[model samples]
Target: MNIQETQINFTILNRFMVLKKKERLAHAYLFSGPMDVGKGETALGVAKLVNCENLSEENYFCDVCPSCLKINSRNHPDVHVIDNEDGGTIKIDQIRGLLGQVKMRPFQALKKVFIIRNIESMTIESSNALLKTLEEPGGNSLLLLTVSSLEKILPTVRSRCHTMPFSALSLRVMARRLMSDDGEFPQEAHFLAHFAEGCLGRARCLKEDKIFIQKDAIIDQFILSSKSEDFVKKILTDKPKTKGLLDILLSWMRDSLLVKVGVEDARLIHIDRLDDLKFFVERYSFFVLNDVYEESVKTYKLLADNLNVKIPLLIIKEKLRYE
Candidate 1:
């Protein structure tokens, strides 16, 4: 398989490539990151690499090999993607069934790979049952758990697996590959890349939800919050969306700082509004600029911590006034 294919994570593949070559691949792995960041695809790629019928001289898989084809079609008998059968909750029974399978040998491949999605969805009883498999994995067997949050996972389970933490994609990376779920690309893909915090899957969700259409209006709110009490009142009524606005507004301030420091346009998140970015850069001195940026960051954190959105947002607006 070509590891460099778009949507596949190359950094992760390369790491696994080295591990596989050295014969040091762990039997269990915990891929912890945002659900939308291609963790599942990475697991499948690793599975293909380990079990491919023919590994190239350079050590990548042949895409047309039987193992590769079976994995691509989800028909590989030994490579299992376990589901949360109890209506989004993995019950003790499902994990017990998995343990039984784990003890058996691979049907065809070099190793059996079981991928369990979002360990957070499993109950305490279910997780405890899973621990047994981790403690004593079958020979030539692998378990891959894609987790939403590390803290939510049982510490015993978390410690047993080799953890691979996925990072959000950069703006430049996202802008380059801006195709959406329906295969339609957008003119504001650069902005969407920045807006979704560079998680392509989340960017697609934001696109479908029409959050892109509201981008300008959100920025306008940031700009007008300092000028009109009535506008601020209207914005406060939609507190949930306002949380998104704070993120955008914080990004705006951050871009403005980057612009003033002569950072290249490519590095700035607000490149779509270059003229506007330049306009804002000239409005504040560096000291005042950084002050607001730090405050906005703290404000965004406060909102994320589940505080009343209006309070921190209003505090940010007062800071945005920047006396």
Candidate 2:
């Protein structure tokens, strides 16, 4: 696909064009952003642009050339993509394999490109192994690393490469993209867009998730029911367990704060829960909403740290009741 047609819009494209014009592209680059913001697509586009035999004045690939066709089919010998293997981490052995390949000359294109997705998922040993390659990469080879969580990446790895930050797309742009594939999405597209918080991947995932629908219903119940007993019971008995309910509640509370503070552009994962959000915002003071938001964030962090999910939920329940 052409660079312009990608889901994301930013100065990166223009910068890339300028760099290509000057023939001064970086040997290694780190594309950091939230998931589904077109980082991978952009990386592929860069590869195609760099290697395209038939290039246009706009610097876009002809897409009709042999090189472009090979890249599109993911059979280009010069372009290497390294992803997680068999649901496991990218190990030191895998990095060693890639490093071996990098030593070889490009098979077709003038430059060879190695694209690594989810670099944060690389094991510590693997990251250290890759550091040598990054420090003294081959002259004709380029490394592109895509990561969602920069914190998980080794500081040494992060410092060696040029960094590009990708932000989430606007709801309107996301909705438009979704509409192109599924026309029926427009009405609910805004809602999905809000919930996706600028990440197209999350929006698409939410669209396919029945849990989001159930969460919407639960939020409706929370708004309609005077007593929290039924809502709590339904949450506790849900198929995915209380974690789903807790997640939705946290998202709702976040939206409540956004709405209360008059933030015009908030990425709420539960856009359909606006009524519930409104109710919460109306009933609770800004301070209370902020506290709820903080608690929700803490709960998410605790879960990430392997803390027992029940403890956080119980604490959240008690806080809600106390408030």
Candidate 3:
């Protein structure tokens, strides 16, 4: 979908549109929000709007224009997406390469735009290098940095750019968007929307994820693993092979924790499995369950940093089994 048809209401989108009309857009902006909430997409939308030869009267991009088409396809020479493509860190070399490109004038569009995804992944050297770019970004150049939170970015970097905060998308908005596509079930839409934690991008990805194939087995193993070592081992083997496993595990722990704390059923992510989740929660003390949840989060961060996943997986298993 194009920028004009966004389901979630983004304050930044309206703010930028005003800036575009006033011709007072900033050189650098920090887009801070939860993952998959469309910070990156919004940055691209800004690029399209600023460069489109035929912007609509409603301040939307004419997606048919050459600039909009190239940006949409991520082939625009003036629009660049910088992310951690090598190893797990955005290295200094990448920043240097980007700076070299930013030095040049726009090839076709009126403004050159750079959208940096997961800017928090930048190494110390890279972050330092980015400071130079942020401080002296060229007149016609725009830098858009997206991170889960401002705490992840350097103070110096954060101070240099206008910060735009995004919150989780509403459940109704996300579910409605999911159901808009043909052949999607309403029941599945409700579940996917909650499971995505208010992120439309995550909702879409979850709809097609292969890990859901093991849902029943995984849930059963999680419930049984409290007493059976064999079940725990099976869960380890059955864990999602992708990074998405952490999200699934976190969701289960979160649901159990919510039940243990007497959170309302309506707020539970695993509403459909409330009975099973309550059963599981009853088996463990609140402190133990909370510790496991904290450890799981730490393990997820380590895994994202390119550490071996098996060690953390075993650690989590042991925590769940004996803690």
The better-scoring model by TM-score among 1 and 2 is 2
Q: Residue by residue across 250-279, what tens digits does model 2's lDDT show?
A: 777777778898753535555555655666
| Candidate 3 RMSD computed on C-alpha atoms after optimal superposition onto the true structure | 4.6
Worst 10 residues of 2 by lDDT: 1-10
Per-model TM-score, in order, reads 0.75, 0.79, 0.77
- By TM-score, how accurate is candidate 2? 0.79
Q: Any residue pairs clashing in model 2, and if so which?
A: 195-268, 195-269
For 89-155, candidate 3 gives per-residue lDDT tens digits of 9999989998998768999989999988899999999999999999778988999999998999899
Estimate, for each residue in 12-118, the C-alpha lDDT of model 1 and write its tens digit. 88888888889998889999987688888888888988898888767657778899999999999999987676548988888988888897989899989998888
- All candidates: CA RMSD (Å): 4.4, 4.0, 4.6
The alpha-carbon lDDT assigned to residue 113 of candidate 2 equals 94
Per-model lDDT: 0.79, 0.75, 0.79
Model 1 lDDT-worst window of ten: 179-188
Ranking by TM-score: 2, 3, 1
